[model samples]
Target: MTPKQRRLARRLRQLRVNSGTSLEAAANHLGCKQPKITKIEVCQLGARPDEVRMLCELYGAGRATVESMVTLARTAKTRGWYQVYDESANPENIDFVELETDAVAVSNFEIDLIPGLLQTEDYARAVFKAGLPDISADIIDQRVELRIARRQRVLDGDLSVWAVVTEAALIRAVGGRDVHLAQLTRLLEVATLPNVQFQIIPTRAGEYMAMGVPFWCFRFDDNYGTVALDHLSGTTFLEEEGDVERYRLAFQHLCSTALSKQDSLALLRKYIKEEHSEWERRS
Candidate 1:
């Protein structure tokens, strides 16, 4: 299912539960089996606009809410632009790209590397090559190209981004000195964007909150949100209210522990100067 379908499915489930309606009752109202309702709620089946309106009405939703959901139902089946890269992406990564594309705002915390949306081509290529050693070079190139396209779509849209990276990321010098320098330059450029909030957790912070993993929380219209955790095995998306809330709190704490946006930019500048000076001396 597309991200829109996922959100709509979730919203429908919430509405039903809040109204004290059973799946059997919902199925009866729609003149379908309980499994159909289950499938709709789980995003295995797309809810038609009429069905969405009917369900909303049954759930005692306000007229405005009904209209809003019906509209989402109408558009939920549309394919995202990222589907073009389906051949190169795994199912989880494809879902992530869909969510990222649809999100109005994004909060990202990276532990040891630059956020993909803020990474340069050389930097992203290096990351893919390092992480997927067994994958064919062609696949790696496709992933890198997809990353660049994803970045452009998000930045070019009205998306608001708050990204926090560890100081380690800036100092690691990925893809050697030249690529690292260019990546930092790209980050500085992105940081200056009005819609982007960039911060860094200094190494001096010494074992801070969210020390173990990196995650992204996506905020969408209608106040729905989703959290994504990427691990070695695959990407996991969390939509449960409790899980989303926990990640949100963790992200908030991370932001508090990070350097302010202004200081983060200054830190980037400091690193860039050091890299340039080292390059000059070597040359």
Candidate 2:
């Protein structure tokens, strides 16, 4: 999920939680049941255009603020039809759908899945399968396609991205032998691009991923940096000044531990060579 959706979900949740608004009160105002209000507030349910309008009025969100949110929620829904695939497609992914393609500088720390912005179809499919173990086959494929498509947008678009990958990511082999091989090659392909930077934090570097999973920190031309945490429930974006500063420091620590660009490329190249050699030996 991009940071925006995380921010929206987080903001709405905070407002309700802080304002001491009861489900019955908000629901009563919206003419919907308490469960509906709960879903909207928690971002579990996709917000309708009119529902957003109504909720903003009930929440006493300011006139301009309400308009901006209504627009954001509408943008959240217009998803170019092809966006149906991402497994993380919730308020977070949707909220940032329109903004990410416009970002100038982006950095990510991937503890588990490929940086969402850089994943290949097979790798994405494998990740999605693990996340939605019970999903039907057709839906899984659609979602995988969507995820790969999103990654391609970042890779192919005019965005500059720096991704720091934990060593565990390289070793886990998300999609089995063939899938792993393809994903590794895909990384090598994108790593060659001028606007993209990729680094692998090897196990020898150790202790980082084990100590805590990685999160992404995004910086936009708006002169703000956002820290996002992805959870099983989806993603949350941190906006508090202290929280944002802490993430900046965390990213700097991670950057210091990650492999240098030249060495990181060599490591990936070596992995590719080893993969084919092992494949040839087995054959």
Candidate 3:
């Protein structure tokens, strides 16, 4: 099922239960069979906007809630924005992008690289080149374009972002010193946005919780959350309550151990200068 459909399905089911309604009753109200209602709630069948509105009304949802669910139901039937990059994008990455579209906020922890949503075009291109050397340049270009589009949401203030990175990641010259410095400068600029927050874990911090793991927690206003763990193989999304909670807690701990927002920006400036100086010296 699509992300929006899944979200709508889950919320519809919850609303039914909260209203003390049974599947049989819901089906009867819709003049359908129980299996049909079950399929709608399971996302095996799409829910029409009228159906969603009716269901929400039956579930005692307010006018606003009904309209919201109805809108989601309508959008769930449309194509996702990332469909254009299907040929070049990883399946896992596409899935993450789909889910990210509906996310109200994102909290990401990076162990050795800048978070994807905060990366500059050059930095992201360098990363794709280094990580996926087997792919063609055309494919890499497509991926880079996709990354830039994803990054735009953060810039447009459509999505709030909280990012935590290790000092090592900031120090590593991913795309050479010039690209690294540019990336750092971009980070400082992005950090100034009210919707974006950045924290850095200094190398001196030593050991901490989830020491070697990196993950992203996406929170939605619908009371659902997802944690994405990116690996060499693919990205794994955890939606179960326990798994999401664990990652959420881990991110909180990481934030607490990392430098404050102001300090992080200060450290980022320091690195930009150091990288620029090193580049000039070698030149």
The most accurate candidate by lDDT is 1
RMSD of 2: 7.6
Question: Per-residue lDDT for 1-283 in model 1, tens only?
Answer: 6777889999999999999999999999999999999999988888899999999999999888888899888878776777888889898888898888778899999988999988999999999999999999998999999999888855785788899999998988889878999999989999899889999999999887788789999987666789999999999899987899898999999989999999999999999999899878988
lDDT (10s digit) by residue, model 2, range 61-142: 7777667666656665445544553453544665444445534667788875568777778888888889888878787777
**Per-residue CA lDDT of candidate 3, range 164-249, in tens?**
99998888889987788888898889988999999999999999998888899998866568888888999888876678889899
Q: If scored against the real structure, what TM-score would every candidate get?
A: 0.90, 0.67, 0.90
lDDT of 1: 0.89
Candidate 2 Cα outliers beyond 4 Å, as residue runs: 1-88, 96-99
Model 2 Cα shift for residue 282 (angstroms): 4.4
The worst-scoring run of ten residues by lDDT in candidate 2 lies at: 1-10
lDDT of 2: 0.70
lDDT of model 3 at residue 69? 87
Off by over 4 Å in 3: 221-223, 279-283
Question: Who is ahead in lDDT, 1 or 2?
Answer: 1
